[model samples]
Structure formats: C-alpha cells, structure tokens
Target: MQDTTMAGLWALGLGTVKAQSTVTKTMNASIPTLVVLANLPQLALSVIYVLVNRLLSAMAAAREWASFAHSRKGLRVTVPQGQQRSTLWLQLPYSFAIPQLVLSALLHYFVSQSLFLAQIAIFNARDETEDGGASVSSIGFSAIAIFCSLLTTGAVLVAVVLAGLVVRSEAEDGT
Candidate 1:
C-alpha cells in the first residue's frame, strides 16, 4: 500500500511537470495556432486516461489493502528464501496498476510534446526561406503522428479497464 501510494504521488508530480513543459513550449513556439490545434486531441486523450488510471489505481489499492487487513494474522514482512509464498497478491496492483498509470502519464506527456514539435516543423516548412524547408510530402506527418498516438493511448485505456475488471472479479470471488 505504501509503495503504491508513493508511486501514485510520483506520477502526479511528474505529470504536472510534463504538462507545464508542454504548455510552455506551445506558448513560445512560432506557430501557436498550429501547436494548439495539434494538441487538442492529445489533451482530451490525456484527460481521459489520467482520470481512468487514477480511479483504477485508487480502487485497486483500496481492495488490496482491505484484503491485507483481513488476512493480517497470516501476513509477514518478508518471504523466506525457500518459502516465497504469502497471502498478499501484491503483483496485480503494485506491478500492473501503478506502473501502467505512470507509463500512460509519461507516454501522454512525450506524445503531446512530439505533436507540438511536429506542428512547429510543419509550419516552418511552409516558410519562403532561401534554402527552403520540408516539401509538401512531409505535411501529413503531423496528422499521422497524432493519429498513432491516439491509437496507442486508446489501447492502453482498454488494458486499464481490463485490469479494473479483474480487480472487481477478484473482489467478488473473495480471493
């Protein structure tokens, strides 16, 4: 429970930093319009993923700790070398839930940053410089990038939902 709490807090702090960085970069960019528009999809996706992930994390943590309290008499601080067994099923919430949430948060941040950068590149490519910039061939790259990121975020969201379902089933079974 302590570990999961710490991980969740760390994810929250890291996500805030990343969001601020994204906003700062977008504000300072030469193509504010393009950057802002490009960020819209990612921003919506981030909000959805963040909310769902946080809820899953909290629910899993609560259930796991409740199970622990119920089995307190059988609980031990550490498993012996030859007897690596215990009543606590720590892997589900600790290994899967918290890490996935953190990964989603981190991935969302980087993908959003990449989207902003790609838009800036595309906007710059349209300039009338002597050396010239990217041709029309690269114009669709930003859209493709945004689409790919959205797809990946959707897949992760599905996985988180599945984890929540597993937690719910386990609770029902009294496991």
Candidate 2:
C-alpha cells in the first residue's frame, strides 16, 4: 500500500511536468514553475487522505481478525460493550467527506479538460490548415481524456458510497 501511494505521488509529479511542458509548448507562453508546484500540496493532501484511511481500515480489520483468531483458540474473548461499541477504529469525516470528494472530482475534471484542450491546441499549432476533424494525435489524447473523466467519475461514485457508509455508521452509533 505504501508503495502504491509513493508510485501514485511519483506519477502525479511526472504528469505535472508533462502538463507544464505541453501547456508551454502548445500555448507558446512561459508558464511559471509555481503553476506546476501549486498543485503538489493538494496532491500530497490526497495521498495523506488515502494513507490515513487505508491505515485505519487495516487496523480495524486486524482487530476483527485477531478477535476471531483468539476465539478459535478456546480462550474467552471479552468484548467491551460489543453490542453498542463500534468495531471500526476510525470514524469517517462526516461533515467534510462530501465536500472533499466533490472538490477532488472537480479538480480531476478540470485538469483532464485542461489536458484535452492543450492537446487540441498542440494539434492546431502543428497543422494550421486542417480543421473540423480529428487526427490520430487528437484521437489519442481524447481517449486519455475520456479515461481520466471516467476514472474521476468512478471515484466520485465511490465517495458517494463512502458517504453512505459514514451516515449508516453514525446511525448505528445512535447519534
């Protein structure tokens, strides 16, 4: 999991570099380095969110597994207020989850759109005469854009499910 997160961060950094170069080359303007670096904090925050959530989830799962294993060993396992207590170790951020999810989805959508537009601009800059049609490069970029859009959409849907889980958990807590 840590490896995956690190890889994700690395990929995001690479993508930022590519995006910066593409935008500069296509738009024929000098994009400030800060423009690329500004997104790093948000990306880092996303990574932190993933890490913390996964870590908490793993802890909860480990607790459950250990309890089951102990029970199987013929030892009496005492659960504290097992009926009322939550098995989950980490509480979901009820108030901020939806907003964060929406922001993340929007960020992804805008970034993908920006990339798509940059590709189109590059195509136009290369072939000034051709118009109103798709070239191979444009098509390729379009496919990537579509994939990014779909990925973000899927993430948003997952957030919706997580939001539901948070609400259900709160209800279970009789809050």
Candidate 3:
C-alpha cells in the first residue's frame, strides 16, 4: 500500500511537470530553473507524508484491535506473528480513510497549482517589427494556492494527531 501511494505521488508530480510544459509551450516560454529547485521541497514533503501515513495506518490498526478486544470481555488480542490476513485499508474505517485520501489529493493539487511558469511579452514603441520585443519568462507563485496547500498540509497533520490520540485513548480505556 505504501509503495502504491508513493508511486501515485510520483505519477502526480510527473503529470504536473507535463502540464507545466504544455502551458509553457503555449506561451512560448522556457521553464525556469527555480521550478526544478522547487521540487526538492516537494520530494521531502512526499517522504514525510509516506512516513506519517505508515504511522497512522499502524495506529489505526491498533485502534481497531483495541476496540475488538474491549468489546469482548476476557478476550485478548494478539499481534500477528508473521503474515497478516488483513491489510491497512481493511483495518481503517471508511470515515477516517476517505477524508485522508481526499485531503492528500487536494494537497498535491494545490501544491502543483501554487507554482507556475509565466511568460509576459514586452513591447517596445521604438521597434516597428511584428515581434517588437522579447518575452520575459519567470516562475510565478500564487499566494492563494500556497495558502490552500499549507492549509491542507495542516489538516493532514491534524488528522495524524487525532488518530494518535484516538489510539492512545483506546489503549488506556482497554487497559
């Protein structure tokens, strides 16, 4: 599951690059170097996201097992010694998993939209040629998009904390 999630994120990054290239082509602009530099932080974020996701999945599974054990008096839940029958998705509730998936998608979309390559044509009055002036291309940042991406990131972090808290509370109550 983790590998699949990481692969999806990589595919999303590639798609964003392709989309940016298309936009740049339409505007007759070259991609800025800063765009490549910007990806480093995104890569780091993706790594962090994967790790946090793994942690949250484990917590969710523990919460599920705790609930099961608590519901049945004098019953003990033991961790699997080897291969497990159920996957992480199966352990997580739909209400918890669905929103996490949605938030992750929104986060990626907003992050990709936040930075863009933009071209502006500079026209000169002195030049009478059809193409009077050169075009200036640069990396542009959208404030609103950045803000939204940050908000989505915050939401993911909050979800992790909430999940951890739920697991901790469950463990305490089960004990």
State TM-scores per candidate: 0.47, 0.29, 0.60
Candidate RMSDs in order: 14.0, 14.5, 11.8
C-alpha lDDT of residue 54 in model 3: 74
What is the Å distance of residue 82 in model 2 from its true position?
Answer: 36
Question: For model 3, what is the alpha-carbon lDDT of residue 131?
Answer: 62
Task: Give the better candidate number (1 or 2) by lDDT.
Answer: 1
Least well predicted 10-residue stretch by lDDT in candidate 2: 135-144
Ranking by TM-score: 3, 1, 2
Find the candidate with the highest lDDT and give its number.
Answer: 3
Which regions in candidate 1 have their CA more than 4 angstroms from the true location? 1-30, 65-70, 73-93, 101-140, 143-147
Model 2, range 78-169, lDDT digits (tens) per residue?
Answer: 35453444332234333444555565656555454434323333246666645556432221122333345456656655765675565456
Per-candidate Cα lDDT values, in order, are: 0.53, 0.45, 0.62
Tens-digit lDDT string for candidate 1 (72-104): 433333553443445334434455756675667
lDDT, candidate 3, at 35: 65
Q: How well does candidate 2 match the true structure in TM-score terms?
A: 0.29
In terms of lDDT, the poorest run of 10 residues in model 3 is 14-23
